[model samples]
Target chain A: MSEFEIIRDIFAPLTATAPGAFNLVDDAALLEQQNLVVTKDLLVAGVHFLAKDPLDLVARKLIRANLSDLAAKGAKPLGYFLGCVWPKHTDRASIEQFARGLAEDQERYRIGLYGGDTTVHSTKTGPLTLSATFLGTPPKQGMIPRSGASLGDDLYVSGTIGDAGLGLAALRKEFKFTTVDKASLSSRYHLPEPRLTLGTALAGLATAAIDVSDGLIADAGHIARACGLRAEIDAVAIPRSAGAASWVAAQENRWRALATLASFGDDYEILFAAPPAMRRSITVASKASRTEVARIGTLSRGEGVLFLDEAGRPIPVEKPGFNHFT
Target chain B: MSEFEIIRDIFAPLTATAPGAFNLVDDAALLEQQNLVVTKDLLVAGVHFLAKDPLDLVARKLIRANLSDLAAKGAKPLGYFLGCVWPKHTDRASIEQFARGLAEDQERYRIGLYGGDTTVHSTKTGPLTLSATFLGTPPKQGMIPRSGASLGDDLYVSGTIGDAGLGLAALRKEFKFTTVDKASLSSRYHLPEPRLTLGTALAGLATAAIDVSDGLIADAGHIARACGLRAEIDAVAIPRSAGAASWVAAQENRWRALATLASFGDDYEILFAAPPAMRRSITVASKASRTEVARIGTLSRGEGVLFLDEAGRPIPVEKPGFNHFT
Candidate 1:
């Protein structure tokens, strides 16, 4: 079963009568009357990142991953509770390095570590597992939900997609690139920039929003499916970094390459929906937040998603997203 | 380095200016002005519990552990975000069983599941990791802090201590017991009852409180150390279940056996301190909450903890409690 089916059929009932839970459909949950929004994400070494990856970068990546969720809902993060299980016999220096990483991000995000647990795995071979529960205050205009999109809403995304995917590919030595390109891409994978400011700015403007962690097309589909609308996107209109564009240029089938990029996960950018009439306002908000925004699609009265090429020809995507359980 | 040192020297600084974090010393953190309290706990199969345990029981253990933290702070649990990393190849039935456990507890505790991530481990051998971030509301009298214990405060514990520890021993086959005793002990290890009602009732009366997860003596030390005092316990005063008392009676060295039992972890009972003047009030509250209470010790000037015999002689304890990292 897919992750969605598991959540909907097996786990959704656990949510009971809590309306803030959103029936486990939204990226974050609201604490009614407290104006608080909360989100949690767990990462395991070798699954989410290389087991040998530097502890500091791993720490930052974990923090950013959850922050990206809050950003999607226009929540200003207050603090996070961290749950870390280090591998057995991990040295103090390594743990200190991890703390240094948390300190760096804590300063950058202006959030504190509220409280958490740290335990060393009992088995030497056990993986480094980490979980962060982030708490934030929603914008006064209120947090945006992914299911609030309307049929006529125009979809926009912050920053570029595919760079992080390419970066992962480069890290695995799947493809060779220039030193600069490789470094840039690798950095993108290691340190995703959560568009917090942009999300907060768009809270009152965007009808719906979600973070692009499970690929652009998949996340856009989330917004579409939640609102019972079809999302139509121009493949070429999906923003890309210069390196990503160069990589696509070298591929035999440009459409296929672009689709692959759109299907790759880990781009922690905001994918949001707004009315076409709010385009100018979105531009102003994006500029004010110093985040690049691109309009790539529109929601229509239908279901699922449509990926169209420059000539309006549909491109087939075998897999449109990442699902932990398939 | 011990877990406490690692937390104090490295992780504590990350708390920064968040006073609610209590410098990462408290079991739960307060969200200033929100009247909300939050706590997080992580459990890994093979470390926190046997990997072969039933999925439903494991699920309950995870939820109860976090709820135990809330109980220590005298908070009424609102809901929780659950982060689960299921083992690869896990069957749908297993996950369904896990959700069933959660459903059972949500109804029992009047709490709901909020939101969280569910991912399958990339490797088959990876441990089944789970985390729960619980949110709660403090009583009208405000939540009790572990550091609030006074020199003359009486150290009391709700429910019998060491039963869960003895239960673990029975499960491990380190000891032989009657079939009924074994089942009872094993159940205690698998499912701990969090003293929520007692904790809530004691909020206005108890000067300090903490859950007895890391053995009775170690937890008492936590309160004493936090408040810059010493805790002196009358060995005979520590409450024990019928099976535990019988087991202790069979040991060659009564003091050693008692010490061993006190050193075992996972009791899930609330260990707290209240002024001596509130003894009557505490008794009334305990009866009203339907929770048994035992005055095990007293707080005094100085540091550390003293486990004393009937004649007031201090008994030596080689190891006071369980430490995840040492």
Candidate 2:
């Protein structure tokens, strides 16, 4: 099938059942309701993923990355706009698989492929780039902004952290692992499950929220800066996956490995904060969604992120979060 | 002065003044509004533009392309999401200039820069690719869908056509031009004025509307297919710029050139159809807005687009419109 055919047959079918599916063929899609929450992300082939990675996984990754942003704001996705650039020698099968993956994710998120533009290049060295814009409805109480955290609010995380980071290390073959460890690590890297349920549930309950695209400490730092409050993370409370522990145990630079795992980007887990009084209710909601909820830290009356041991001793780092420029 | 810095300093400031400008430092900006319209466009360097094109113009072109989509639906742009891919050797100055241009267009359009992603590639063979997603609001009466046209509706165009195509020809050195001709043509190529005012006014009046991106005839064909009606255009009634007649007079392939101009894309003008009863009101509205509106065709109980001479004879062409796949 041609690229257009692939998009029409696979991706198009997935969009048929979306909320605002009527105008998919138009230049833009119209939402039925008035209020909206929108976000976008760009994924470049080499920088964001290896060219040799499975095309289906790459497509899924792209969707998940954007969905994570929506989840952070406690928004339910309505539709997505896609922009794709194809390489010269891109085969029909590859495009078909990519479309199939996109279709799968669209159905999973209940989002229509509203409208987008596609272009092809003659050069082989150019990496394919996929940009997705996610549209959704903000909660009635208003979205949980990164800047809404309050001093003395409890820090919480939905789902285990560092799996995606460790998964990346395993993918690069920089670390060796057993069969189960390999499967767990690879799954983390290839299929990041955004905490959409937790995000939507925490809309009114959480004081502040952000998806852990960067490492836990770094993402928390974003909340701190935005809220004009210092965040203190109890390092001992960070939840690590089964494989992550094994990987760290085998490392001579255990502390460094743990820190890297804590700082590595691509974990789609939601890290949020709320009043200490609301912690029990937040945990109940998280459990109802079948996602783990842990109190990892607290917001303080200061700036930046402060990491502490169980005894509340400060842990120093060069920086708290990932800087794209650096 | 890195790419991120340019985004933070230049583009961020322009978007700051608009509503829903959230944490630019986050993975995505959260937009809170009712009724969102989302559209995206991808522009590849060599494919959509020349490598040596001014950075400012490139940025403006990217924004205009997206804004034009919103204009077609009578949607007021709320914000934009940009996805940029730069070459490895690209310096901060070029990116900063591009950001400045982006800021200029954002302020002009009264839209914010919500969020986007950026990446750098190693190959010089790959042209820079910029993708923009525009979030907008539908008019109170709702968006004018391309499929809403009815039989016996009068077809209208907001502005003169074919300037951009001619501008492109001038840019490729395929045509020689006088200083005035060069300025006019280059302006058309570099900056497309989207008919936002006309589109907004057309919300309740026009049966259906679409932006004339793929030439008048081809775009008319889209309306015909969507609304299940035949659209017939009177070639003699179609408005043209002063340079159009001169260029046609100078060309040996006058008929071909005229046909080419009629099928040229990037006009960013609105093409709509309305009942005879709304004709007088539409004219009044057009006059009030100071946007030119010409009645160039009529919709009939048939399918496809028919181009006719003054005597009603059909004008034949090998291709009706430009296809992205083709």
Candidate 3:
């Protein structure tokens, strides 16, 4: 079958008249209301993930990456748009597997597969590219914009930092891990879950929030700049994985490993800020969700991001975050 | 600066509030209302267009291609999401030019730039990949779904067809064209204008509508299959450019040329069905909008698409439309 025929056969049966479902073949999809939240993310094979990565894992990662953005602002997933460039060498079975993974992820998120495009090219060297645009509803009160952080607000992260980063490092052979640690680390790299529940819970409580796609320090800098406030992170308080302490203890280059933990991307954790008064409520909600929460720093009156060591000395770093252009 | 820094500098300053914008940075963009119209399109370098295609035209095509979906449903433009993969060797100026083109096109459509991702890849041979998700508001009464066509409904197209496809053929040296024809054909290839105005106007009148991304016969076939009916089109009634007619007349291959026109994609015109009674209103609206309107066919109580010559003889053809998978 041709590309068009395949799409029609696969997607036509999946089509149904949902209340807000757009005419899928139309020029654009229509939303029911005026208040809309949209986000887009692109995943390139090799850079974003290996070409040999499991289709299921790739599908999950793509959705999680986009959902992580929604989690940062406490938005509800409405639906998504997927654009795929299928490699010429990919067989029908592989395509089916990919589609199945996509369907699974969509159901998991309760998001409709509103529309998308798929194209095939003859080029042998192009990476498989998948881009997803997620549509969500803002919080009832409003959204937690990146610009909402205020001076003196407590900075918190929904889960431990650097696990995903460390996972990548391990994947790259920068470090070796025990069998148990290897499984855990690989899971972190393959399926970093978005903290949706905690983010939604903190929507009104958190002054500002952002998903940590780049490293914690780098992403925190985004919040700081957006809100025009300085962020001061205490390195000592930065949460580590269960095995991180042991690994660091055995490492000759402890500082280097620690720094790597703070600089790696792919950590789909939500980093947010809130006033001290909201700490109790945050803790309560965190407990209710059975999710970890930690205060690693504070937003201050200055600008830019600063990391303080145990002795309160500022640590100088070459770069704060992942640079896509570089 | 690195890719990350480039994104920060280019997009950070533009960060305001896309509350309803469904931006990229958030977990998901919120849609204010329901009955959303959503669509996605992917553009791959080499396959879709040449690598050296002007950045402005590339950006315009991205928006226009997606916008065409809205036009098919008689919907209005709302916003869009962009997913881009920057070639590893791409310079800052190229990126800026691309962004500038996008900005201009977004402004033209009154569509907000909600969110998107920028990634760099190691693949050296793949053409730049770009994808866009367009969100639109369904017509007040509702969408003219492709499945809504009824027997005896009149078929119509918003504008001339086959120009873009012919342009491609011309570019490949498969055909020759006069200078005037070449310019017109190339323009059709480079910049397809989505029939937003006509689509909106036809919202109530068109019982079913679809953008003619694929050639007329193929796209019309979509309506036929969707509505579980057959389409009988009068070939002479199909619109054509002046050069197209001349070429056909000169080569005595009018049927072949017409079939090619019927099977090509990227026209971005609306092919719609309307009840016979609504003809007057549609004609008036088309006149007011200064866009040509032609009655090319009728819906029949059958399956498949059929093309008829002046004597009502069926024309033999191998394919009805461009199929993506094949």
Candidate 4:
């Protein structure tokens, strides 16, 4: 079964009593009374990232992934609880390096490490597994749920959409890249910049929002399916970093290249939907937050996500997004 | 390095700005203004439990472990966030079974499920790893910190000790056991009864508190070290279940046998410190909460913990508790 099916069939019932949990469908759980948003994310080496990646970058990625959830909910992070299952024979120096990563991010995000557990795996070859639970205070207007999107809503994405995917590809040597571009792409994969400012700024403006972690088309599909609407994206309007654009230009089939980019996960950009009338307000908020925003699509009375070409032809996508189960 | 040393040397400094984190020394981190207590724990298969343990019991144990931390802080559980890294090829039925276990405990504890992450390891040989972050409301009088114990304070522990360790032993077939005893011991190891009621009841009455997870003596040592005092325990006063008592009776060296019991972790009982004057009040609280409490030790102006015999002679203990890193 897919992750969604597992969550819907098995875990959703567990949240029956928690109205704020949004039936396990939202990006983060809401504590409505306190205007608090809570989110947890797990990352295992060899699955989420290369096992040989720097411990510092691994630590930062763990924190950023959860922060992106809170960001999507328009929440200001307060602190986080961490759980680390260190591989056996893990030296104190390696742990200190991980701590240094957390320390650097704590300073960057202005959040503290509340408390957590650290245990070493019993076997020498066990992979490093990490989990983080982040708590945040939501904007005064409250959190934006992914299911809040309305039909005829215009979708906007913060920053670039496919840079992280390109970065991963570059790291894997799937394609050649300039020294600077390779470093930049690798950094994008290793460390995500959570759109906290834009998320908070769009709080009262955006009808619904979600972070692009599970690929743009897939996450946009999440909002689309959540609100019972079809997210119709103008494929040409999908923003990409220069490196990603160049990479796409080099591909034999531009449409398939674009599809691959849209289907790749790890972009921590906020994907939001708002009524067409709110476009001006979103632009103003975007500028005020100093974040780049691109109008990518519109929510229509249909189902799932649809990527259209410049000629208004619907492009076929074999896989809409990243599914861990697959 | 020991878990305590890892926390102190590597993690504590990260909590410098979060006063409520108690420098990573306390069981649960406090959110003072919200009267909230939060804790996170990670359990890995083959390390924390046998790999073949029931999924339901594993789920319950993960929740109960975090609940125990909240209980130690005199807090009433509100909800929990979970992170499950299921072993590869995990079936729908297995996950459903795990959910059922969580469902049972959620009803028993009257706590709602918050939000969390669920992922599958990429490797078939990967051990299942689970994490939980529990949040709760502290008692009206506020939390009972581990560092609150004072000199001349009497130390108390709720419920029986050593059963969990013996239960694990029985499961491993380390010794012979009656069918009834084996089942009882196995249940104790799988399902620890968190002393929540007793902990909250001791709010204003107890000076300091900690859950007996890393053995009674080690937990007592935690409170002692936190408060710059020494704990002196009467070995004979340590309470034990009938199964544990019979096992101790069968041992040739009673002193070493008793020491083994005191050093066995996973008790999940609350160990607390209180003034001698509150002895009668404690009995009232204990009875009202329907939890058995034994005054087994006292704090003095010294360091570490000392276990004494009936003649008041200190009995040497090689290892006082379970250390994950060791």
Candidate 5:
């Protein structure tokens, strides 16, 4: 059992009666009366980020994570609440930098800093922890829920996957990329671009949607578990950057490399389920947002996520997603 | 400077432009369009609770802290979003206990579990941190802000205060009680009883209000600054528990002991301002809620909080309130 399992077994049941909570399966919750979608995430230093990461980037990443959750729910940013356990040594100057980062993001994302609380943790040696609760609203159609993935729906993902995962590896010096610039890889890991445009465009077009925070198989499995269906993702069909493709080509074990890329977490791209008939709409959406969307799999009457090769043979997954304490 | 000062100097300015945020001075932010009042608080181990504290009490305190914020704003609980960073060794049993505590409070408060996120933080030796964001609405009339204390307003505080402060001291073995039971003091420190009824009643009657967190003097200073006035607190008029009074009476430095008991933090009681004309209304409200209201101070044309003795001379204040990184 992992963090996700603990949530499902112990916490998800608490949300069973709350229709908007989506059983804690979807990225965000919806308030129909308020017409607001809300999601909260806590990021701690050390476990969530490198201990010495810049405070500015730390603040930005915290907000972006919540923004990514909103994007997955097909909602545009409205406002947010922030709660922080400030490291004991944080001075006014450091706090100013953190606030500056949040200000910049609020302006960029058209969200306001609504309210929050700040406390000092005297003994915590790790990076300061921050929790952000983002409130959003769909610009147009109703929210695309994660539980409506009917059988035979085409599974599509936005942008390329595994950049962030590899980026993290690169940060730790565990992996090197000759094809991709180190800065590019690291930026992907540091800052996640929330696909708000594509998600809003998804509206009624995608029956089910989720942001890929966990690895491809793991997050996709969320839709499967929620919709009570199975998802088959083609490893070959997953879009990859030229750098990623080159890195995979350079690997001694190609399939394992591909699995590593696919299973690493923090993609932040929207994975969606829609019927083939709506492929044209998805195409238009991709074109509109100028973000690529690739058809990677299909949904059927089953459970869990299946990773298949070009010839439709099964590919074993070593790490399905970012589940803590697995 | 204190934690509140840091927030005001660093973070409050960021919120000045967002009218919905109320300059981050009020207990909660009003999302008028959403018809929601929101407040968020982060509770960290060591700072907010002991590492070995019961998970049930941890969850309860987290929710109660946010509930206190809502109560201070004269808002009744609607729902909340929770974000928690689980400690590495957190098991299913602890999580279940936490959820049970939350369930009990939700039932007691009539608020729903809207949504939230969970994550595991390994390497955290201290207690896990939790943040709760409460969404509420005014129970009646408009919100009782902190800024409306007129020059001649009478300041009133609901319930006893020093109980919680002394309770914390008792928990840390800094204080011992023979006049009161251990459970009474420990409960005061662990579980804050939010004065929702008193707050709601004061919504229209009280000119200004704030929750007594961060100690009486510190929090009272908030209303003073917000109202651009002065608060003259009569030390003798301050409410205290039998245990706290007994402890203070036994001390050689009686004034300092009294001040320490009065200024210790974690009392979620509501301190409010109303004109002398509203005394009848305050009495009625107190009777209705079955909570005692003590008139301890007065607001006048000045600034800062002043502690006065029975002879109207200043009682030198020390440890005015709780401030982190002071």
Candidate 6:
């Protein structure tokens, strides 16, 4: 699997950054003469993915996670470098399947494999750890960081929240789901749509932006702290997919369920803030990118991410996002 | 150690790719408008280094390993992205030590931590796996890959070889060594001096070049195949340190010991080939870099690599380098 004999064949062809990269025959890869965006993510098996998860899906998840960071920053994908640490049991067939996933995404995203390293650890007995260092071009409006939000800016989020978290819960048998429901929820957890076009379109308009890898409340808190503003997200205004809506509708305490759903992580949608004056521009960006953006609330001269019910009453949050330490 | 709480303190200041990186507050880092070089290397404990190895040494080795690749391509250090998967037992002190190592090396080589991701992997039971994606600017002469070796070119290698392999063997107790000997060999094994200046100097002078991460003979073979030429390495001309020299001298069968040492990977020295006409330039490069370059071989019109004894006879290679399966 991770043996050099087969991996060499798979890796060599992937190194197609010619002219500058020297087809990766050279030790390093070359970057464009522009302000390149660099981001990295570490995905550990058992933590990032299930052991039974297809290698192809795992590969896609890895690429998409890093790509999501770029999209959040209003950057365009250029290329990426991968580093994988394989366990002893990994074989050539497994590696080939993983490459197939990467190949599919590379074609879809129009990114090349600049260079990478694949190492085999014979003594490793746990889940494999994989990482990617993604490179890209900055948006015309430059980088949109979380620390740019301002007071009175309207907070908006793209796509539906809580679907991924519910999907994971269903997968773990914490809840029941129909065949169609399972597919929709699991796929949401597996394949996150990195809002590249929407993020790019919002580059000049959105004051601050972040991809919702963590839970909505938690990530909003990051933007809030960075800009020294309070993010007041109206829970009733939070968008939800049909599947998520139906799931929550079945619960007796619907608002509580909504709160629970929004608090779970893994939604790779764009959450951003923009002044009310840019509402027209924001609508234009959403229409042009064909992505929906819902106005949740506004930033105030306060601290942390605050949630409000329909009556505008503050709702206390016990947990914000995923924490490594339980 | 990998906890986001304390890690926040360590990671924020390391985002020295300022003005573009947004002080690690942004989702990504930005590069300058130059011919950028990108390379990544995965270092796994118990595989790339000893599990008991000091964290500082581990950090230096990781940075140097990636830097070595860039050096081979005639690239100067710029910045790097780090992806670290921490096992359960790691903690704040360990991460601090690791950061200190990176800080020391960042000062040693002019590079910065552009961005990085650190994740807690409680399931991982093996030695930590740390990966770095290094970015650099190529020399004005451009990148020198393995595919440019011309016929009748002189083969040159920087520093010494086999010391790493021997050092590993000595560490494994396969060979005995005194305190001075052990320190010299282990340091060579742990701390590889990337031939940055020499490689930049060799950019135009050398026809092709590669860093000796794999064994010297094996890497020479790569250039041979890339250039469609045969490499004839005079084994006796291969350089050695005083410690290695004395160890080999003490052996009953010095050639066997030499072969073993040469075949051991991890010697991050530069091995290059250039036309004899560029002797003056090569000499000037050596002088400027203050690094010794030894002519150990020649390129001939043929295929693969051939090792020659003092008598100019071909010596068979049973195992050219380290194979993961073995």
Can you give the DockQ of every candidate in the order shown? 0.20, 0.50, 0.62, 0.19, 0.20, 0.64
Q: How would you order the candidates by TM-score, starting with the best?
A: 6, 3, 2, 1, 4, 5
Candidate lDDT values, in order? 0.82, 0.80, 0.78, 0.81, 0.76, 0.84
**Residues B154-242, candidate 4, lDDT per residue (tens digit)?**
99999998989999999999977788888888898999999889888999989888888889998888789778999999999999888
Number of the candidate with higher DockQ, 1 or 4: 1
Candidate 2 stretches with Cα past 4 Å from truth are A1-10, A89-92, A307-322, B1-7, B23-33, B122-126, B276-279, B309-313
What number of backbone clashes does candidate 1 have, counting pairs of residues 3 or more apart or in separate chains? 0
- At residue B122, candidate 1 shows an lDDT of 82
Candidate 3 chain B, poorest ten consecutive residues by summed lDDT: B20-29
Q: Model 2's lDDT to the true fold? A: 0.80
Candidate 6 chain B least-lDDT 10 residues: B1-10
Please give the distance, in angstroms, between residue A146's alpha carbon in candidate 4 and its true position after superposition: 1.3
List the TM-score for candidate 2's chain B. 0.95
What RMSD does each model have against the real structure?
10.3, 2.9, 2.4, 10.3, 10.3, 1.9
TM-score of 1: 0.90
lDDT of 5 by residue, A1-326 (tens): 23234334433443333454444432223343465667777788876777677777888888888888778768888777677777776666676677667766766887765556667776746347889888877656766777778999999999999988878887888877764456787888888888888888888899988888878888888789778899999898888977678778889987788888889888889999999999898999999988899999999888998899878888899878776644
The TM-scores, one per candidate, come to: 0.90, 0.91, 0.94, 0.89, 0.89, 0.96
Best by lDDT: 6
lDDT, residue B262, model 2:
82
Give a tens-digit lDDT track for model 1, residues A41-85: 888897788898999999999999989988998889877777888
Instruction: Flag the better candidate by DockQ, 2 or 4.
Output: 2
The TM-score, computed over Cα atoms with residue i paired to residue i, of candidate 4 is 0.89
Cα lDDT tens digits for candidate 3, B189-245: 999999888988888889998888777998898889878899999888889888777
* Local lDDT at A298 for model 5: 99
Candidate 2, residue A117: lDDT:
71
DockQ of 4: 0.19
**Model 1, residue B262: displacement in angstroms?**
0.6
